[model samples]
Target: MSDVAIVAAGATRFDERIPRRAEELVAEALLEAFDGVKGLSLNEIDTLVTSYFIDARQVAEEWIIQDYIGHIPRAAFRVENGGGSGASAFYTAYSLIKGGLSDVVLVAGWEKMSLYRTLMANELIARGLDVDFDFDVGAIYTACYAMMAVRRMHVYGEREEDFARIAVKNRNNALKNPKGQWKRRITVEDVLESRLIAYPLKVLDCSLISDGAAVLILSSVERAKEITDDPVIVEGIGIGTDTMRLGDRAEITNFPACRVAARRAYRMAGIDDPVRDLDCAEIYDSFDTVELQTYEDLGFVKKGKGVEFIEETEIGGRLPVNMSGGLEGMGHPIGASPIAEIAEIFWQLRGESCNQVDGAERGLVHSHGGAGTAVVVSVLGR
Candidate 1:
């Protein structure tokens, strides 16, 4: 099988109310993508895979992006799997390259969420919930996660203070990242004292509803050598899903899909233990509890040991996770956030990250959708 490598990657600054068209945001990220790669160009790309969630707002925006980005005539398509859309597009390109159907592929993810009011935008996001039940009950992502947080508290003795630490860590990390959205230095007290969205989950514990774009170029290993001297290899990719309704699952304490996906990716990458094998990670942090739960599902820690992660596994810790601030502080643009995670890992593996982890060589990126219904876990190495 042919190996795939990421030759270029970039992301627009993640923020709310970005004053630019969706295609224009994509164009901005593409500039950073092709900046250092001396010989690459849009014309050389054989395919384009775009990702976005709010398709109902503007039908077939991918075609518009294709035309605006100068890939109108070549093969181009859109991918939507809620928040996992970006990595879904990525794996599409990865398969195309691995299968020899395409030599060079461009994957871009963008979302213009700022176009709608926060309430309407949330309603759009909540569309991913089981409309017949969860939506009717008015259970948004925060509420779904909050219920899980409460269960985690009863079962594992986790506190709101424990989850609040994730917010403190990720937002603090954002201060070092220029492309990250939040720059305010906050504390656990700040997280707890912030406006309460759902019980145990305050405004500070939730990810932002931001507008952004991220781009990456993928190619065969042989072709990767031509693109750049420093190529970050896509070592393994795995995806899994569970029932959309949280009530349908056997348990709600953890995402079964994440564990399944991570196991598959880890097996493919020959990873015996993620904490020992990975130098850093950028997992989904749409909520602070999600990050802690992912730490267990991804095999970084055991079931009740999540707080140990919060206590010890940050930068300069055993395994630095979310050095780019993750969705919590970096901003979650849904479709583009996973690609932004990949961009951060791409830079870290290449020793080019703004907040570089010392001697980093391998990393993991997790893309999550719905109420832990869909997950994509990928392992990256230099």
Candidate 2:
């Protein structure tokens, strides 16, 4: 077996409207990635993996992107696992390189979500749930997360204002991220006053329906040295899944899939204590409550202490989390989100992130799909 390294990463600004097709967005990201790594050519890539959730326009999106990007003759395919598609695609590319099946691989993810109305996009996202049971019962995506938030509050005595603080913290961090969708600093009062989509989650608490793309170039350890001097090594990767129906889970307060995945990743990375071992993190924050629960599930804090952990995850805290504003402020483009999370970690490891964490050497990236039914956790270090 061989080691894999991420040599270059790129992403377009996350926004409501990018004014371009998904393939075009991918091409832009690939060009930027190429610019970062000197002497790297598209022809040198032995495999291409793309990730996207909805079929906004066409099928076989990977083939379409390969044609648009002029990377023909290279093996290419698509991976779709709801919101975790991007990280799943990245894991596939890492496996190829680690197994010695390919020396160089290109991983990209994009979503042109602005093409549809908010209601229509919500409908599309709801398809990830059980069609006959959940979706047909008039369950919107927000409601799924809302139920979890309600349960967490009921069991742990957490208040809505605690969740609001998560939104404010991430939005404040977004002010430093040039590519963040919402750069304006917000307050806990602002989140509380916002329109309530569900019982506990306000409009400001939800992630934006963004349009964006991200790309990463991975290579074998031997080839990485030849391509770039600073390569972020893929230390560990783990994927886990729970029931598709949120009701099937024994506990709604925490996502078991995230706990399973994070434990595996931490063990593989030789991390006995996530809070002390990890320098920073980029976890999926589709909803502010989700981020709070993830802190407990990821072992960053003790269970039922997620609310208190908020201050500890701030910019200058013990272990900064979501320095890229997470999905709340960075914008969640479904397929592109997980890839973008890894890109943020890569930049942090290289001291190039817009909101760099001081002396960050090891970082974690987490992504979830289908109401926590699936999770992918990865550890990266310089």
Candidate 3:
């Protein structure tokens, strides 16, 4: 297979209110991405892969977006994997380039969630769970993650404060990110004292529900060099899924799908020690506990010792994680989350991150969907 590289990346500022339609958000991101890649034109793009979840306005939304972005007559499609939709769409673009099917591919993800009420949005998100086993039992998305946190605390002696620390770290990291939604520096005490959304998970611990979009321009390795001097190569890609029902999984604390996906990505990237080899990571931390658990699930730390990895992931530590503030501090637009994660890594590799990791070479992006049911892991390098 041919190598794939990301030539340009862009994102709109994440916020609770963005007076733009979904297609407009994507178009805006695409415009910024185009500006980054000098001489690249929309007509040169061979394929357009869009990610969006439950847009009530239209079916086959990618087609609409393609026309709105003035990329008509190009091949286009949509990919949805719950919250992992962005990474899934990105992986599709990577495959298109790697398989020699397309030269230049545009991947965009967006969610105009501010159009719905909070409860309505929750209900829409809850639809992703197993209807018979989870939704029917009155399980919301947060409750599923909360159950995993409860089990981790019980089995591994993880404390609620440990999760709170993750919140504090990400929120502090957000202060440096211009595009992040929550820029206020927070403390563990702040997180612990916040209202409880679910047992063991406070309001501060949950990711922000916001409106945003992210875009990435990918091409064949040769095409990438022609497009730009600094190209973030898609060194490796892996995706997997686990049991849909939360109770069906044998292990609640660890996501088997994430482990499987990470192993595949690491093997493909020739990474022996993720903690040592990866310069930084942008993980899908929709919940603080999820970030802590991802450290172990993605092999950044040993199982049951994820809480200990927190200090090591700090700004000056060996491997800084979520320098973009993750989904928690950045914003969670479901389908756009992983795309933003990839964009953050792309910038980090190019020495353009707002919270730059000095001498960064390789970065890992891990995105989770449907409460750990689906996972996509990618390793990008300069």
Better model by lDDT, 1 or 2? Answer: 2
| Candidate 1 per-residue lDDT over residues 1-382, each given as its tens digit | 6899999998899998799999999999998999858677788899999899987678889899989988869999998888899989998999999999999999999998889999999899999998888899887888999999999999999998999999999999999999889989999899989999989889999998899999999999998898898999999999999999888899999999999999889998999988889999998999999999999999988987899887665789989889999998889888899999999999999999988999999999999989888899999999
Task: Please write out the lDDT profile of model 3 over residues 19-136, one tens digit for every residue.
Answer: 9888888888888887888668888999999899876657887888888988888799999999999999999999888888999999999998898899999988999998867788
At residue 327, give the lDDT of candidate 1.
93
Instruction: Provide TM-scores for the models.
Output: 0.99, 0.99, 0.98
Ten-residue segment with the worst summed lDDT in candidate 2? 33-42
In angstroms, the error of model 1 at 254 is 0.4
In the range 223-273, model 2's lDDT, one tens digit per residue, is 998899899999989999999987778999998999999988888899999
> In model 3, what is the error at residue 343, expressed in angstroms?
0.4
In order, what lDDT does every prediction score?
A: 0.91, 0.92, 0.90
The positional error of residue 211 in candidate 2, measured at the CA in angstroms, is 0.7
As a whole number from 0 to 100, the lDDT of residue 241 in candidate 2 is 95
Candidate 2 wrongly placed segments (more than 4 Å): none
RMSD of 1: 0.9
